[model samples]
Target chain A: MNRFDYIRPGSVAEAVAAASEPGAAYLAGGTNLLDLMKIGVAAPDKVIDITRLPGLDRIDWLEDASVRIGAMVRNAELARNTAFSAAFPAISEALLSGASPQLRNAATVGGNLMQETRCAYFQDPLSRCNRRAPGSGCDALEGHNRSHAVLGWTPSCIATHPSDFCVPLAALGAIVEIEGPDGSREIDLAALHELPGSESAGGIALKHGEMITALRLPAEATSFAGHSRYLKLRERTSFAFALVSAAAMLSMEQGTITEARIALGAVAARPWHATDAETFLKGKKAEAEVFAEAAGIALKEASPSGDNAFKITLATRVLTRALTLAAKGTPDRVPALPASVFMSSEGATANA
Target chain B: MTLSISLSVNGESLNVPLEDTRTTLLDLLREHIGLTGTKKGCDRGQCGACTVLLDGKRINACLTLAASVDGTDVTTIEGLAQGDTLHPVQAAFIEHDGFQCGYCTTGQIMSAVGLLSEGDAGADPERIREGMSGNICRCAAYPGITAAVLDAERRQSESEGTSV
Candidate 1:
């Protein structure tokens, strides 16, 4: 880790002011930031500890029936909250599917949203990464690009966001509340992460000193609680990042899909929200064929950035499986393995 | 610049001065406080060898900054025993031979205690394995580790039942 000055701000305003400096970074859970620093990827001179900041660790049910999740709420806490989990099970599953129990206990929602990519090239300081160093050139393009992005990727960068929590949030249309030097504002979670463009390194859209305060899930988001699922394909059943993941939510009436939301992860720079597929699923019958078609529509535009053509097919299958599970109706509780594709919906050992 | 902070480690409170702000809780314990039980395996979040209870919640101490956890209670592997008596998880681990090299035992034990307190994973072996996935025993003591956690869970529940 780099030698730096630690500043614990007492309030959000104070934290914003302290982090507004050029070489300062806000510290929430420190799971990602600290690791990045250890690898010499991020070297902030000033560390603004915002863990002590007040009024940012709450889970509020607003009068409008929307739920506002404070950014500082730990991932494990939110995943275990009965009310929150019952209302938004996909989000809970996504949260539980990420990292490990120890990490989830310390990682905060805000920090999850702000986590950097897990690309080996990005983490290796010796490698040439345009995201790590602008215009330095991307070594991932020619190197082991098996895990590179297949959607919303450009020549500048092909690294995918490594956040499982944001996948369901993007599908559910969650709104992010931001606080910065210019005051507070809100944006869709889908818009929070920027896609790699010719002139962009492709990370978060937040300007300097801007911090995510809370995430709001609208009242309608809870409507799909009965038919929501997140499915992840990974090398292991636990303690692994997603190879290809999908969040599928549906509101069905008499075996017919009334509304649907789909988002794919690890295939794009951001959670690839399948708006076209979502539009195509409305009023369609809740069937495997329909789900397969919807999955096809979702990945229609996806192309292999490098040697990841298999990921395009894998991502399509993951989405189809997620939608199929969503149509089966969400289990009474989250599976023991959370979103692992190998686990049964009931989390039974017989299947394992 | 040096900073002063207070922490309650293993039921003992102490006011410690930190000369470096970048010191992690793992380093603070092993280097400053001289509690070497919490081994530093990966020195990153990837390995759970530095697992500790922060305010009764299990977290990777290597990823946790010492200054950020000021005024918080931390419990390490050294804190699990009651004088001569071992903690239920520790006892069960010994009974089941949950460790081969024993380097990851401290973290596995602490993580097990936290998992039991969380009450999410029950006596189910698969759930126990999933809950304890963070602690990587390179010796591949997973079967024994799972059995130990299951036995500990049963023992704790039985004790509670009899006490009640």
Candidate 2:
């Protein structure tokens, strides 16, 4: 890691003030920032350690029935909270399915949202990556990019955001609270990550000194607690990033779906919320054919960016399986392996 | 710039002066404090060879900055055993032959201890396997590792007069 002056700010205001200067970076969970620094991708002259900041590690229940989670709340703690998990089961499942237990314990909510992409080209300083250095040309475009983005991608950048927690949050329309040099503001979680345009590179939308303070889920987000599931496809059974993943949440009346929310991950620069498919599923019977049709609609606009044309088909199957599992209702307990597809069918339906 | 920080490591409180703020907790323990029990397989967060307990939670030490953990309690593999008697998880690993090259043993043992305390995974072999996935044993000693975690869980539960 590059040598730098370390500043441990006692308050959010102080932290922002220190980070507002040039060559300053806010350090939350060092899992991503330290790695980037070690690889010479990010070399900040000043490191503002915000891990000790007060009033940022809480999970507050609001009077409006919404929940406000502090940015410093660890991923492991949020997933294990009984009340939080029961109300937002899919979110908890998504959190548990990400990274490893140790990473989850140290990683924070804000850090996860701000983590850089896992593109090999972006991590390798020798490779030409436009995201890392604008106008450098992307090596992943013609190189081995079997996992590159298929949606909302441009030739300038084709890296996909590798966050499982963001998939369910995007599906539920979560809101992010931000604090910066100017003031505090809020934005929809979907708007926090920008898509690569034809001219500009894609990345987090936060300004130079802005930082995420907390995340909020509206009261109605809990309505799908009865039927919500997050399913991920990976090469390994655990401790791996997703090849394709989906979060399916539905509110049913008797045997018909009243409301539906679906989001796909690892397929785009941002979480791909299938709003059209969600609209089509309303008032329809929760059946395999209906889910298959919805899955087709979800991938209608997805085209291969490289040698990963199979991702479109694989994404469709993963979404169909996720919707099928959601229709069966969430299991009483999160599967032992979390969101892995290998979870026994019998165990999934036993709670229904 | 040098930063003076105080840390409680393995039951001992020490005031260590850091010459560089870029030092990671893994290097602080291994190089500065002379605690070589923790290994560094991958300096990045991908591997769990540098696992340690920070305030009773298992975290990757390599990714954690030494200056950031100023007042925290850290328990490393060196702290697991009391005198000559090994920790339950350590003893079970030996009984079950839970390793081949034994390079990843410290991290696997530390992660298992953290998993047991979390109480999320009980005596189920599948849960144990999932919980310990962070620590990769390249020797493919997963079967024995899973058996060891299960045995340790059962033994601890039995001693506590609880049914697994």
Candidate 3:
């Protein structure tokens, strides 16, 4: 890692001012940024430490019973919060299923939102990765791409977003609060991540020197509290990234679905919300056949490469199973990945 | 630019001058403070050999910048024992044979201590496995490690009960 200047800003304004410098990155939790720095993936000229900034670590319950989570709130703290877990179990399960206990203790919501893809080629400084260097090239497009994106992928890059929390947050209709050099603004959580486009042009649309301040989940999303499931299919039973995951939340009335929210991860450059599937499921009976049809609709846009063709089938099955589990209110019954997915000769572990 | 940072490690307050602001807390402990008990296996935070307690919470020391943790309380494996008496977790590890080569033992123990403090370690073996998943044992001593954590939790609670 390169030696750089460090500044511990006293307030959000001071932090934003410090981050206005060229090649300055905000440091919160340091779980992902520092690791990338050590591996030569990212080297900032200045690191603005925002962990000490006031009012960025509190979890507040709004008057409408919705929750406002500070961006700096650690993942472990959020997962262990009784009220948040009760209101949004899918979000809690997604957060807990990610990384590990020690990592969750140190990882913050803002840092997790800003994490880069776990593309091996992108991390290797010698590899040709457009995301690492604009217009350089994409090695994952033709290399070991079993973990690459099968949905919303462009020729320039096929990397998939590695976040498990963001998928559920997107499904929960959370909003992100940002503070930039100009002023403060809010954006839907689903729009916080973008698919890879030409020349690696797609990512969070934050302007330079903008920092995420908080996340707000709307009160209406709490209606899915008892009927939500987060199903993550990974190579291992624990401590592994998802190959295909689904965050499903449904509202049922008289055994019929009134509303549905479905989002996918590890299959796209961004959290792929299955708005079409959600629309099709409205007013339909919560049956396995109905769920299978909805799952098919959700994966209709998938364009998998040769190496990751199995992901389409895997994602379809996972989504169907997730919808069924959510309808039954049995989130704990979500199954693990089969041993064959990991033991197959061509399916190497994309994340280690 | 160089910075002067103060830290409270194992109840000892120390003021140190740092010339490299990018130095990690793992390097600061192993190289500068001469506390080599905290091993540096994977300096990229993937491995938990550099696990330590920062403000009573277990975190990867390798990922933490030394200058960023100014005035915070840090505890490492070297601070677990009081004089000659080993901590309960350390003693339990010995009784359960939680090692083969033991390169990851200190990290495993510190993680267990932190887990118990966080109210995670209990009679449930699955929860213990999940909680200690961060500390990877290459020797595959997971069965022994799980036993040690459960035993340590039981012993600590028993001692507390007796004192109360």
The lDDT for every candidate, in the order shown, is 0.92, 0.93, 0.87
lDDT for model 2, please: 0.93
After superposition of all CA atoms, the RMSD between model 2 and the true structure is 2.1
- Once superposed on the true structure, which residue ranges of model 2 sit more than 4 Å away at CA? A344-352
Candidates sorted on TM-score, descending = 1, 2, 3
Q: Over the stretch A117-140, how does candidate 1's per-residue lDDT look in tens digits? A: 999999999999999999899999
Candidate 1 CAPRI-style tier:
high
Clash totals for all candidate models? 0, 0, 0
Query: Against the correct fold, how does model 1 do in TM-score?
Result: 0.98
Q: How far is A91's C-alpha from truth in model 3 (Å)? A: 0.6
Per-residue lDDT tens digits for candidate 1, residues B1-164, read 68999999999998999999989999999999999999999988887999999999999999999998899999999999999999999999999999999999999999999999998887777778889989899999988999999999999889888321
The two-chain DockQ for each candidate, comma-separated, is 0.86, 0.72, 0.58
Tens digits of per-residue lDDT for model 2, A1-352: 6899999999999999999999999999888899999999999999998888999999999999999999999999999999999999999999999999999998999999998999999999999998999999999999999998888898999999999999999999999999999999999999999999997878999999999999999999999999999999988879999999999999999989999999999999898899999999999999999999999999999999999999999999999999999999999988988898888464442112
How big is the positional error of residue A82 in model 2, measured in Å on the Cα after superposition? 0.3
Candidate 3 residues lying further than 4 Å off, grouped into runs, are A330-352, B162-164
Q: What is the lDDT of residue A53 in candidate 1?
A: 84
lDDT of 2 by residue, B1-164 (tens): 98899999999998999999989999999999999999999889777999999999999999999999999999999999999999999999999999999999999999999999999899777788889989989898988898999999999999999976
The C-alpha stretches of model 1 lying farther than 4 A from their native spots are A345-352, B162-164
User: How well does model 3 score by local distance difference test?
Assistant: 0.87
